[model samples]
Target: MSNLNFTSGQTIPNSVIAPVSADGKVCFYVYGKTHLLADVSGYFPK
Candidate 1:
């Protein structure tokens, strides 16, 4: 998720689809604790 942008019209908390970064390098979208399957390792890996 390099230089990716998110533009949503909904007034969401922004925490649910929290952004996660590894070593502050790769940033990816991650769902809340309820969706553990959305984890980085669960999908993408370095």
Candidate 2:
């Protein structure tokens, strides 16, 4: 898992690679107004 925290009204670019469960779901927790973007590159079997 990966964790990213940013201050209010902060704009930046970030990249993260994390594994997902068999159900293929992701979760995020935020306090205030925030925008997020995600991309899937490839997948590998366990």
Candidate 3:
């Protein structure tokens, strides 16, 4: 996501499912300040 702006005391929910490398790692970038929460219910076999 790009060009994301939020006001004070605003709440937003965003979910993303991305494939990771061999290390099971991912990266995210935001223009301004944001909070992120990730929950892994399950994973597929490698």
Candidate 4:
């Protein structure tokens, strides 16, 4: 359980957070935008 920072820009509506564990975990956060999947996925790696 750590801090994952992803997706942060003026064009972006919100941000995405991805938590990595021993087995590679992924989580999504929709604070403002959820349309930046491609941008977010680039950092999460699937």
Question: What are the models' TM-scores?
Answer: 0.16, 0.57, 0.51, 0.28
| Model 2, TM vs. native | 0.57
Model 2: ten consecutive residues of lowest lDDT: 26-35
How many residue pairs collide in each prediction? Answer: 0, 0, 0, 4
Candidate 2 on 1-46: residue-level lDDT in tens?
A: 3477777777877766676766988666566678777777776777
Q: Residues 1-46, candidate 3, lDDT per residue (tens digit)?
A: 4534568788876555578887879776755566766687666786
Predicted candidate 4 versus true structure: per-residue lDDT over 1-46, tens digit per residue: 4233455554534444645677776555455554535354465455
Evaluation by TM-score, superior candidate among 1 and 3: 3
Each model's C-alpha lDDT?
Answer: 0.37, 0.71, 0.67, 0.50
* Error at 26, model 3, angstroms: 1.4
The sequence of per-residue lDDT tens digits that candidate 1 reaches over residues 1-29 is 32323345433233233444655553445
| Model 1 residue 10 distance off true place after TM-score fit, in angstroms | 28
* Prediction 3 TM-score vs. true: 0.51
Winner on TM-score (1 vs 4): 4
Judging by TM-score against the true structure, name the best candidate: 2
- Model 3 misplaced regions, further than 4 Å: 1-10
Which regions of candidate 1 fall more than 4 Å away from where they truly are?
1-24, 34-46
